[model samples]
Target chain A: MIDLVSDPWPLVYVGITLGVTALLAYVAKLLIWGMMRQSNPQITIAAQRLGVSIVWLVGGVVAVQELGVSIDVLLLVIGLLGVATIVALRQPLENFGAKYFADVYTPFKLGDTVRVGEHEGRVIEINAMSTVLLSKGDALVSLPNSAFLRQPVVNLTPQAWKEVVVPITLPGTMDLAAFENTMHRAIARMRVRLDRRYPPIFTVKSRTAQSTDLLLTVMVRRPEDRDPVLAEVNLRLTEAMEKAPASASRAASGASAVDPGH
Target chain B: MHSVDSRWGHDAGTAAEPREEDRDLFSDPEAATLATTAVPAEGRMNAVSVLINTQTPLLQFPRAPRGRHAMWEVESNFSRLVEGEDYRFSPGGVSRMVYPLARRMLTEGVWSDVHWVSLNSHGPEMVRLPGGITLHNVTIQPEHLGGYGKAKEAIWSTVHGLNSPRSSRDLFWTDDYGEYTYYNRVTAELIRELDLAHDFDLFYIHDFQQLPIGQMLGTIKPKLFRWHIPFDSRKIPAQWRPLISTYLNSYDVVVVSSERYRGALRRFGHRGPVRRMYPCIDPAEYKRAGPDDIGAVTTKFGIGPNDTVVLVVARMDPAKAQDRVIGAVARLLPRFPRLRLVLVGNGSFTSASSGLGIPKSRTWRRHLEETAASRGVHDRVVFTGHVSQSELESLYERCAFTVLPSVREGFGLVVVESWLYHKPTVVSVRAGIADLVTDGENGLLFDPDRPRALDRQMLRLLRDSGPLSRKLGEAGHQTARLCTLDAAVRDEVRLSGELGEN
Candidate 1:
């Protein structure tokens, strides 16, 4: 009470930093999401999360310093902890990173027969750390996720080369069935490049009120058309998402506005 | 005081009531069989939600009155046009067979919500029914509807062994096939949307026209397909096998109408559970008409007191082999001068103006009229086209016997209808119901391919009309109980409930 001027300024400064930290984090997430519209949903999510974490960390350091707490030892401890975590979890981090790439590039999926090194069986599952195979004799074969990148894996499923499976995640702002129907019509126009016997199929992996996870599968008429077909299909899918129905506003009530392509 | 003939101004005939005679057809009308036995499903775990998909909509809306609004955009209150005047319910197995099962299952507390999706080019988007049932209709563009019709017809003709192998070669790659896929995709989209909202416990799809729907759905939910037509594996082209198998394997279970078809499904390489259940009917729906009904029917058709009524109740189509029965009727008319042939029915919904509007049924009916006229029996033949349920029951009661002469039948519920009336029936060997007939006991079996065989069967029934008719009629009444709602509904509900629980 007697020295209110000095006390209120420090408290007010800390309060301002806290409020500013929240605003900065929100804006940074929006910018990251806007810049990554064309990227995979996973990458967009990761970038937004990383931006928020950085804003909070810097703002938190300043707020504590305003509170008159020494943060030198705290900064040193946090830096050392980050380095130690990277070193200790190096193997798991590699597997996790490899899983991200394998999801995008791997030709085989669950239920495909794949041969990695001397292992040969039907692929039962693909998890973060390993891929599981059920052998012909009913034995289980688990292989490391990193092995998919380290060695050449042969997919022995019949006509597997013609198959192209794309994983897609629809945001709360997009309608899945409407998006799928439009995506199918857009892809059917390129029937000359696709196998007529096998039409494009969109399968739901899982769904929530917030989002829907899906896998879009198309069979290419020729092996060489795979890359172009993928690019064209992605463009069509992104357009479908962007052109969501008006009811989509109900689902994504607080969705951000700007989306510049990644 | 009941009215006489032509109540609705349907025919230009006499309105006088016929004289009533002694009418004692059966001793016991309630001929209960073992199949009619009931089981209390107290152990059924939970109420389920079901989604049924078919090619034909259960209710077809009328084309909107000139252009007040499009039919598809109209509300389902059905105010624009009258139910019977502008549009009529489809009269065939899909409506007759599926509707009863759905209703009975709902009544028995097996389901919480039941949604049926089907193709309806001219219909409202949604219709709510009694007992928690909802109907969804999916429309395809009219420009593409013609192509869709052609593709389905080709597939139908091929599967029924009517089309030659050469015409069916590479049929799936044609331009029409693309339209067919388009129709199915739109239907799948509608169903997926409904499923997302309702979260159905199971999906029940029907027939070859909508077979690809199972594969297109890609739902991990339990899926059951009922192949309502004939399933002769040898008839399907080798080129179509791979794709057909892919569609069939997508379903958790496939149901065929006969045991022979079950064997055929296995031979067709369907790697799924195949169950053979008889197509059923509800006895309560068919009530016996009183004397006034019989009198009005006789007066309208101009039946004499001593004239024998030989009934052939079938839709006017070549597959129904109505011409074969007409031929048999001509042969018997010379010996039994009292014989009068009553052909009861018009074209099916496929031939109706509101439906797919195929002209095959109309064209075949014209051919039948020409044949009957050439055979010099047009005067003796009575074509009572499209009667009401009460009128049909009166005809069934007035008839001395019934005949089923289909060249290839999926499963003849008409035979079951005839049996329910306690009437002797002569069945075609090619019909699915022929498997249910025991040559001389419950019913007589004849080959529709051989008109003389049907002719002989007709003669035998004419000679020994008393004991033979009564015995066969009573035995048939017992057999009819097997196909009743009380029995078949049990199997149907069990299939759904167990699959849902798993």
Candidate 2:
């Protein structure tokens, strides 16, 4: 008891804390995947925030023991470092975050002509750094994604007001044919507002072993209803992904009864 | 002489002059010497590798196998079952015209190996027929089957001038359009896969149903598209021009059945190489039935010798305009009491249960029956659903003359069939065969829409006695020679060589 201050129990506590933090971080990843099985973007973002916070918390404790300092001093130093980092990378980080949100919320996409601030041109490319637009005179103009958050942006292409683009990511194991059929049937249910001449087009942008990126374009009758339509489209896509396998199984079984000419 | 030769040479250099016809013909000394030095080989061991595609398959088994045996296993060897028992030749233009060309090409050594790809839902995956010909079947799901059917029907109706532009406006944007694209894509994929294995020298695609296939294939190989239907630019909608032109331009050459169709294709803005090759059948296949064959067919149909038969051999579809023929017969029944109108053929492969399963043919046939009944000529008209080739040949021989009353025809091959049998035919002016017909010369032409045009033509043929009928039938026979398999094979081979060059 007299030498309690000099005992190694505090270091042991820090080690225990770090171990728990590491374990929690791994568990949180699994939980995030399970909870976001339907691919809810908010759940993914929140899970990522929790994971980073846990990493920093564990690092703080480890730093305190190595410096021969108290946990309190380490936390103060860490907080200052985080504040300095945030301050230094504020604009870029904000733009990056805005781009993430814009991917899900923005009505216009690459190849779409849009007016943001004083710039109006066809979007040639959308990169993590910025969105580049090509003017009629063939001049390239780059705009930071964060500008979309602060300024009033308007899509200028004719009938672009009616366009709503949805970005979707699907697992590689999922059958594309089945998914396409299910998505078509699901989208057909919302045929009232959609222009019949331009039925929803689902284009595969990129694909990999783990996942595939797809763009779904639909033309709406009214310009003001874009937001609500997007939410519905996203919900329908998730529901379709869930319901497609069963329908595909039925089709496969039915096709088996009759020869598929294979 | 030297001064004169020099002056001549100088004059040739200074003068812009017209060349003599014989000189142009023998302009190249090497070619002229080769032509003169060598007796042109009358025949050679020539081998042609061809890829053939049509909406209709060459062979459709009458029934799907009872058990779990695969079609591939069944079709590869026809020895497992009898020919007439297991499968019957699919009748109509495909079996009549296209099959004979392929078969004759193989037999005559014009083509060595033939790969025929077609839409076959209930066929074996692959069939190896006689004469080293292989059949590749393209299959689609039943759910998409309906969509494909609707899309093709829309296209057919639009092209035939049956549907209004407003009704067919959304044809390219629906889910059915996707299925249509899927079917074409599936066919293209099959062709590409076969090309990978066989490396065909030429590709010949037939009919409007497969119009997009040439474009979808996107291959560097020679692609030839045969627009087997009438291609009237006036009938086409403004919205569809771009897409149709785009597809048509994909082919290295476009072949139509008649000069009129060729002109129509040009009007449709197809700047590609276009040729008019008459659709033909093997004249040798039309077996000359003796008295016994005719008696058997007449007995089977329960028609007496005194009955004046006005035969129409067409599929039971509304577009064939059987009702117009019936109306003409109804009007003639009062003048000639012994007239019997015989309508041949039933539903197509599309209407059959084992195929795409569209019921348009049944519905259209029912409507025709109702029209005959309403017109009070039900007993006078015979609805012979489907007949064998022997029965058909007998019917053609027994009839005084035939009438092709289609509102719009691809090319009245049946008229050519009648001509093959040496029977006079009254053809619709709307038919592609109208290009070949001179009124009252080889065959008669009548406007299908005009009130008494068909009746007038029927009366003209029926009232004629010895010389007129004989003269018309003989003239028609001469025209039939131009569209015979022998002529078609030569043209096809020549066209194939030309297409292969570039």
Candidate 3:
């Protein structure tokens, strides 16, 4: 190995690679986020993080190789640790993965009375591993998120079928009010097909420094109209999400004084 | 003739001599409305920023005339244009009370700045009211205004128990309500943006038209909603319960005009505390007599010294039941032939020639005129379309008594105005202010439905009214202290501070 760990050249090479790795990881994260900002906010975050982690893992291997460390043993140890972690957290990991799908596709929301498997109650919360419900008898039930995929669920709320909630993610730099106004006007164009009483409303589900999570709720005029309204609204939402960043940037620069919503 | 009658010992019947032209109100433009005065209070209170949302603006701007360009500008510096010439103050008691409250709140240290948002399609986008108050106008399309008006009026009538709400069952599901939602949503959107900029400590929403605002605002900050109309839970339709309840629950606190309304709100299942804060005015805002106030009205309206001015202080709406007063006047004309009913309001902001463009006031005014003529008391009835606040105060001073003939009044603050001037007032039993009336002690209460009941009360007030008026007015004046802005300010500040802290 020619004493690579003690050599100045090797140490400098390792430092340069680490710098490149950080730069590459940051650029990749930004590009991925900018491209996938309209996806479910959780999914966007996970995807960007996963990409950066992969870059870090590969760069660490190269750095160790440059330092002439025992690469085979390190790989073996990392592989065993990964296997042990997966084995120990198998059920939780499955539930965690299931939560993402349920969050996107589940018909029932928090505060709705719903039935799944044998238990029924108002949904108090839905975590990564379990969906919690507060029963009428003041009991709490925690159902595995994965069970939502296997078991048939029934929503007991009035006109629950008329509701279609779409989850959207926007970058932190975007103006929420402007986005809301845009979405409102967009949804208003389909008013004839929608229930007149229930105009579309966008509620901020959660927010973070990097991104914001919002849920858009709309009511269909007929149960049969749900699918089409969802598809049409989704398209409009995607378009508005695309324009929001631009609008926000324009507003920041004082480029546009016209506010249609006002 | 002897001044004192055995039945009612009112002795001031000979104070003013009768003028024949007072019988004919056809030619006087000033009688069409009253004259004006402006006096801004100078004081200070706790420093807080407040946002008030009302469906009706304190001032209204009709479409500008063809040759003129002053009123319909996009934005106006009110200082640049005159009050009456540029824009007229809205004619209902809501605006009358709210404008002064904002003024006093701003003049005093209570609020550092006040932003009022209203539906004003014809007015400028922003108006600077005197002091730190700025009026933000939200104008909806004329096409949408009709639907908004219809839906709001439906809610108003149903809550007031004025008519059977057979049509309101479908109100939330109709296209008209869509427009109502649109207006509230737009107003809420604007409010939210303003909140972001101003970071207001409190949001005070008023009346039924903006009920949806609390929910639409979607802010967790403390919200205080005032239901200015009658709130009898039984009168609310079954279908409206869920919808109305949802909107009502959005507020941190619900304030109504009376304890009765507070109880009704509790019965209606309002989640939070229901506060009974009586809508009040600045007692000083009302002048008992300005030197020119009485003469200006007498010359303009053809009023004579001998003619007894029997006043009805309300807008020209069927809900106000000015016709009931007219009917009562017709019956009383036989005994007190010199008794003239001076009906002192034209239309509210909801009426025709307004941004809302509802024609109810014009139609109702014609109906009242027809009612008076048919009752053969046409010439004896005086119609003053609108009046300035000082002129109203002067009229309050000149009149022997005032009548709040509303079929269902939220709170007869006009009764308080009458009391402030030491003028006895006859109020309807259904009025929210009737709770304050002690029946022959402070004010008289009657039922508008029973025309004869109101007829007799008017006769007693007119026949032997002078002594009774003096006593009632004196007692009523004691009660006025309880409802003035001065009295309510401490509680308002306490409530706002409590909400802001927690």
* Cα lDDT listed for each candidate: 0.76, 0.74, 0.75
User: For candidate 3, what is the interface RMSD?
Assistant: 7.5
Ranking by TM-score: 1, 3, 2
For candidate 1, write residues B139-236 as lDDT tens digits: 66666678778889888888777786567866666657667776776677567667766788889998888887887788888999999888888878
- RMSD for each model, in Å, please? 8.8, 13.1, 11.1
lDDT of 1 at B90: 65
How do the residues A213-233 of candidate 2 rate in per-residue lDDT, one tens digit apiece? 777778777876776666667
Interface CA RMSD of each prediction in angstroms: 10.3, 7.4, 7.5
Cα lDDT tens digits for candidate 3, B372-429: 8999999988898887765776688788889998888898888888887777889898
For candidate 2 chain B, which ten residues in a row score worst on lDDT?
A: B1-10
Candidate 1 vs candidate 3, lDDT winner: 1
Candidate 3 lDDT over A1-262, as tens digits, reads 5475466898888999999999999998888777764455456667889999999999999998988787999999999999999999999998998888888788999999999989999999998899999999999999999999889999999999988888888886676655765676677778778875565655666666576677888888899997778777766766776676432321132211112212
Model 3 residue B253 CA deviation (Å) reads 0.8
In candidate 1, which residue pairs get closer than 3 Å at backbone N, Cα or C atoms, i.e. clash? none
